[model samples]
Target: MKKPFRKKRQGGFTLLQFALVVLVSSIVSAVALNRFEYYREQAEIAAARQVVASLRTSLQARAAQLLSTGRERELQQLASANPMNLLLWKPENYLGEYYAPDPQQIGGAGWVFDPRDRSLVYLPRNARSFSFGSSKLLRFKVEFVRISNKSLALNQVSG
Candidate 1:
């Protein structure tokens, strides 16, 4: 008597197939994570740059007003009251000081005036603060350079 026919069985994936799928997925996830991190950093850098630009414009406008109005003494007083006014234009490391100029503090450390060009320079602390949500805080440096009136004119500097 002939034996009943046996049937072949094929259903779930083999071990090799499962491992390949897992490996591919892990690689894809890693690449995606790396790209995301790069974009985050780029965004942070751009924000920092924008803050610097705004500060520069503000300082320049103030300087021009003082020069055009012949408010040298007031400017000096303001500088003395807030030394950071000068240093804010210069590119430097953040030091955490944001005092406005005062007459008494004029011509001190972190403050310099170009007599020939009639420009003042200083550095201020907390010039730029970047936050990622409520978690991270980043600080940036700012530099100020005041050229003489003649040089300023030649360069067509605008406030």
Candidate 2:
């Protein structure tokens, strides 16, 4: 007696196919995450730079006004009236403090001045060593070396 014979075929993907899919997905995810981190770091750096630039401009404008009008006291008053306590200029406390001032007050971080040396410092969210250089003549440079939870250093120079 001859009976009909039939073979059933596999219905789903093989183990190798599944593994390849997973591998590809993992690679894609890793790339995305890396790109996200890079962008995040770049944004932080840009923000820090912007803060430095704004402070430099303000200081230069104020200094020029003071020299032209001989209103040194007005400039002092402007510095003192900083909305954030971070701008308390003192030689002993070069890194005065860090305050996230209202956006309307100051777009980014706060800053202090060393009236003696005419050097400007930009304080980050914490009392770290994040600072920039500014002279009475408005010449300035902003540096960023590293930033962490507790300490920050502006030891890098960029052209």
Instruction: List, residue by residue over 35-88, the lDDT tens digit for candidate 2.
Output: 987676566556655655445555555556665777655545554443122223
TM-score of each: 0.46, 0.46
Question: In candidate 1, what are the lDDT values of residues 71-121, reduced to their tens digit?
Answer: 755554443333235444543432333333332444332333333333333
Residue 144, model 1, lDDT: 37
Q: lDDT (CA) for every model shown?
A: 0.46, 0.44
TM-score, predicted candidate 2 vs. hidden true structure: 0.46
Stretches of candidate 2 off by over 4 Å are 1-11, 73-159
Q: How many clashes (backbone N, Cα, C below 3 Å) per candidate? A: 24, 0
* Candidate 1: Cα lDDT at 8: 81
- Please list the Cα RMSD from the true structure of every candidate, rounded to 1 decimal place: 12.1, 12.6
